[model samples]
Target: MADSTNQSTVVAFIHTYRPDGRLDSYMSELVDAFVRCGIRLHLVITNHIVPNLDSTALKKHISEQRLIEYINDVDPEFIFTTNRGGITKGIMEKTHAPILTWMVDHTPFFHHGGGPEDLFCEKDHCIISSLRHVKVFESTYPVLKGRVHYLPFATKVEDFKTSRNVVQDVDISFVGTYFHSGILENLYNYYADSPETIQGLLRLAGKIQSDPDTDILPLIEAYGIRKVLEDFNYNHIYLKWLFVNYISLNQRIKVLDAVSDLGLRLYGTDNWLHVGAYSLNLLGCFQFQKKIDTRQKLVELYQRSRIGLNISHHQAGGGLPYRIFDLLASNALLVTNARKDSDLFHLFGEDVQVPMYKNEQDLRKIVIYYLENEKERRELVQYCNRLVDRGFSFEDRVRSFFEIAGCRLKETGHGQLVKVDPDSFIRGLVRYLYRCGGNKPYSSQEKAAPAGGDRIKKIYHRYATGKQRLFIARQVVPLIPNGIIDMLRKQ
Candidate 1:
């Protein structure tokens, strides 16, 4: 081993097929951030995630023993991963490498609004940025508390530094697909089942004599909504929802079909592959599109693009995505329906903000404006690029990550915990929001405020749950491989 100051290596684990996701971008930014600091990074993707990595182009990245052997071979000081489903959890127990799980989205729970999985992820030493995520992890999983740090996503500006302005592929494009919970489903169905949207109803109410309050759905108690409640296993709640609404799937698909008809090179998980085969407007749909391949393409494609759209069905949970920064970095004008939430418009909205689309009308306005006012569109791109460059860029953000994670900067040379913010944290949740973007800290308050959540409860829960006993149990939890345990015994 070189014993150099920058000897640490980061490995990002993707258990599922995240061919198109923010984790990869986080990985990309981590690489640039670390390498610039002289630390090497190896992106450890699961075979499950990259089933087609066997292609000649991607063959060099293929490794049979991937994580297991790589940990042995590289003996990296740090391993950064997002989900803990299969491969990531498998790697955690199997390796001696001090693991760092970048808690991106721990499936089932994220599919629902909240759960103990977040807490479980935190206990495993994954630096978490959001307080909501930290609370979920802390309250649910007995083991993960201090292990999680407030390390925000590594947003970089370099991604948009390119001039890959090729001809526009689609006039207005958004890549997303989602399902709804009882709350969201009811809200959406109310709109879909009707001849008009809630926005339309509100407008009609203004013209006609009717009380607007009557139309409003009463707010559900925080603890009981489909989101992660303090007492419930949010993942289970969501899984149950998925099964019950199995038939309502048709109505959901119908909405997605309508969205697809408008020009966007859309693709999602395998279920949507059928939609492409059936619809004439549907040009193509694949199970997963490669991020590295797509990024290389998007660096050029976004330049010519007018309105890059993001519409999410659910508003509360999903935060700004890493891709939003990528688009801003690529200087693509982002049009989104993220008004109620904070993600895309958080930082860059001050400079080059994209308008929020309430329905197809807002979407149409953005598409046309960016199309007609070419000079204005270019200015917006430049403005967004400036925001991304200033501090919102992934590289700079992850460099902040390096400081927060307490990865001994060559100067400081000390390993410590980090303090990341809520907006970045919310963006972390948005990925779970079926194509929600991340990190929309348009104002200073979000950046400055501690991520919104019940802090006192989290503190009380820690001691009440006997964290000391749990920590002791975790130490003897029979996690290390027998061979490794024997090796240690012999030593």
Candidate 2:
């Protein structure tokens, strides 16, 4: 056990890299929250531990040895990481600290070899994002029966609100990767050699799509295709992976393609361009104009968009994506696909009515109706926002995480803390605007601005296109950076 007397509860955060830095951002936010709770975060970047080497055996041995020594030296109360990719069985065996592995995505079977040399130790625990996955994980791995927990995606309550009135110039917005179509295509092409197997897989995909709440394993097996399973040496996990990937991509493509004509402004990677290559109906509707650079920028985009779209990944059958909460927090009129037995309805209850679509045509109709009916959309947005404010933020998740991990806070905090009041910031900005002869009260177009460093720019840009754009540019644009002002001019 760690020193309980005068020491803060140290957490060894295993920081692995993601191309878009989504997981890294989650870690950074959680670390900040835990820091406030007096947990001393010890960041261990995976790349630094083991270099990319040719010899797999040598690399594994070195990383295991290095990690063993490092864990012993740090003597953290527990090890916390997402996906458990960098963690090994040897490290788990050697360490006294309990490992809290947060599975943000589906449990990959590759992490656990076909044999018993899996990552699980008696003391280690799993925290999955989806409640449905939590149930599935426990049932699949009976050994980890009591060790799994459900902690859904959340946003910072304080940061994701509209305190300052701003205009929502954009109509529809989506912020997520289109996912890797090439990989799925290749898998399909491989089976293309076997027409029967390809057709079977497609039929299996349709079954899974229709009945999403049911496990994919059973669906695959029920399809009665021994060749598909036999081809992968009876690796059900890998097969499930391929089918779910296909279903999720299919769902996103279908829905996005349906709603593409309605001034849809996508914000994500260039992988969206491949949508057209995949389907003729898509016609590059998934093409993203801007890459949302930061969390703040994402919130701003949601805030500025009249409607924020959430297309659930196929795996998320009974659970809502974190984007649902973010869109609600940003006060975007959200339009999402209906999940079978979704956590959304149970979480919010019957009081709030969030728009959900059953199919592509339904989604298009819902989106169009919401766009035309402003009062009803805004009313629903307010209701959802209130529910989110009640308890659905990252702060709430941090507390839940600590309780589940059995970590207690120390009497006094160690890190330097700085606090900024949004109301105060808004007042100051309003005063500045007043000096610039913009004595007009909040306009019809402007709604509250979500918290961010570029908030001033969002406010400036809202009125930038209006009659006041030139006046504000002369007055406030001088204070903002030239580059930022130039960008705002384009908006």
Candidate whose lDDT is highest: 2
TM-score of each: 0.54, 0.74
What's model 1's lDDT at 477?
A: 31
TM-score of 1: 0.54
TM-score result, candidate 2: 0.74
* Tens digits of per-residue lDDT for model 2, 314-403: 877767766887787876888887765777766777544888889989988988998999999888888777877877655576567666
Worst 10 residues of 2 by lDDT: 53-62
Clashes of each: 35, 3
Query: What lDDT is reached at residue 22 by model 2?
Result: 34
Query: Which residue segments of model 2 deviate by more than 4 Å?
Result: 1-7, 10-17, 20-24, 46-62, 112-117, 191-193, 196-200, 211-234, 278-289, 414-491
* Cα lDDT for residue 260, candidate 1: 55
- What's the distance in Å from true for residue 144, model 2? 1.5
